[model samples]
Target: MSRRWLSAVVGSLLALLLVPIAQAADTNLGDLSLSSSNWAEDSGNFPGIWDLTQGDMTISFTYDGNGLVDASGAHAWAELGVRSLHSGGFNFNPNSRYTYNTTTFDLRAEGSSTDVGDVTVSSDETNIYVKFVVNSGSNCTIARTRVQAGSSVSGFPRTWWGDAVPSRFNHQTIHSPQVIEYVYTISRSEVGDGDVYVAANAQIYCDTQRNPRSRIVRTCIDAWAGGVPFSRIGDTRYAIYDSSATRVDGSGVWFASDYDWTAGTFGPDPAGSPSLDIDDKFTISRFGGHAEGDYNLPQTPPDPWNNTHFWFDRDDVDQWQAAMWGMAPGVSYNTNGIYHVVITLHATSATAGTAYMTVNGASQGFYSNGWKDAEPEIYPAGMTFTGDMQQLQVFYGLLGYGATHSVTFSDITIGQ
Candidate 1:
């Protein structure tokens, strides 16, 4: 028997034995971190995108079983009602539309001037808008949000109860499972001092789409999905661009209270999903920690940058992630001259990450792992993170260049 033949046989045996174990482990792992009973049915198919946000608390009931399941069969269509703990019973109809601000995620009454409260809702790189709520009170701040998802086809009403004392509503819906996300602000007094409870009211249609508005998402991430780095720029750092084959310092100016020199948003796409679309000016010669980019890298690498210089660790799995530095051509840094620009930091796998440059929306070079030796390799792996990652830091101001130069930035984002 040749050595090669013997090795192949051994490899085959290992695969047969280990593959099943791995598959079984995955099945045993079940859905993502969120509590399964909250949105999962006994049929093993999760058909809704039920999520909530309190303060630092975040919950994303991802559809784990399958992709794009219809609301007709084995699916759920229902309404979710959220109210302050102090308010008795259900505050509003789960299916009724209230006042919501997309830009700030503030929930209030449409006509009433009374202040409801503030609720910040944003999505991850995968485009899943996970609900994150924080309790500002000293007590545990226990509030109740009711959720009821299921259609008539699924039977009479398969309702789920929230944790604490919650109000009730009963309604019916057509067949199929329709996933929806609702953001609301609750009072600390209402919650008393306990955990927040959320569940479906009854298997009915909780129409959350009557008067819908898109949310303004920022790139404050803790995982390695695709997209740029920072979501906002502050007043400390300055952008450096290449003009006439020389590196020039770039400064930004504030237009209105809301508009910064660099406009738009930085981070993942507003529609969700991990991708990059850079239309701003700035430079992040470093990685990981804060720099000129809109966001910072994951914290796994411990230290991601070295004094405005991009750095990565080959031995450390977290440090070996990919990163990019992007600046709009005609606007930010390349106004005087055009050079190789990096607009994205992509991951190909768990062990490898790569960086790339572009010219005129075209590939300027192959992927480069700016770690040991700056070797050319494949992209790093994509990572998913939930919960409180880190506060997004936006650095704005002027750079100490010989000459005075200013640029405006917009649409800054991270994650894909």
Candidate 2:
């Protein structure tokens, strides 16, 4: 893609279409971000203009399944969106990841990031407010603001690797190779969570494609904004775009934040079910890890759904299996599994490395697969975990039983 072409993508990505909100940016942003659960239920029609600093928002990039699905999992378009950079590494597999921000995966490309837009920002001691239009018309690159520093730009415990600053990374989003993305951030840059930074209708226009151009679009310039290569956790990287930290979706969006793996929140799309249905939440737990926060799970109806997790080596299929109850209609599925879940160590001496589960007290299972319904999963038996079990466990959906189980357990169990 040519530079001028990138201008179009960038320009289109920056198009800020102000939504009419009954409320303004004066409210607490902590309460403004849209409910990740309902991100898709509204069909991208935000009730009002987004109020980022006020709280969370209902993103509009419109993922059929939201980033909650892993890179190799199903997508809003009926395939794996993106793989987990931490495990899959950044292969630039267009269908994988979305964007990058240290704290979490930001899903607010809800607006456009097209040519020169308007942005309103607020700052304080730690975070800053950034509201801009995103429209990638001609600029082959897409997106902004993600913690890309392999370490921390200035010791600001990043949610992901990849830095968020050093100008080069910041600019790469506008002019970099397809395999690299600079995601470092400014050191000690305090941003207010209340006020908002407005950058509306101010970016260049470019075609929005997570992958390369299918056709020759002269106006689209594939540049640094194309994202960089995925970095290994131990690499001392610089001057290169860290695909691992880069969210790869090219929809013109204005404001974005972390993906909140703990909540497994992809956007504002309500699940066919809700968190109240622990088994139904299997997808959520499968999509993310402990965000290290106290996020309440939303309440919803229960569904007898369990994902596949069985030991292939086991000759006797006695009672070992992890399959979702296939009774509900209209819900998506895969042979492998779907949804990434996150769990916090509410009680345990388990090391950070102890974050997986096993079958029949033998073969172990990994969480990097995201969630899928492909291959027809058969969950293993005698499911054991790497750490002590507790009620604090969180996941996208219960990979266990979908029977009429109660939140109140009859006894306690633990395994290693």
In order, the Cα lDDT scores of the candidates are 0.23, 0.24
Summarize candidate 1's per-residue lDDT along 155-246 as a digit string, tens digits. Answer: 22222321211133221222233222234333433222222222222111211232358543321111111111112331111111111111
Measured by TM-score, the strongest candidate is 1
* TM-scores for candidates 1 onward, in order: 0.20, 0.17
Which 10-residue span in candidate 2 carries the lowest summed lDDT? 391-400
Task: List, residue by residue over 1-416, the lDDT tens digit for candidate 2.
Answer: 99999998877766743444465332211111112221222112112222122232221111112223322222221111112222112211212233323221211222222222222332223333233333333243333333222222343322266422224332224323332122323332332222221111111334445557466443432111211222444222222222223333221111111222223332222444222112122211112331111111221112212233221210111121223332122222221222221111121222111122221122212222444444323322111112111111110111112111111111112111
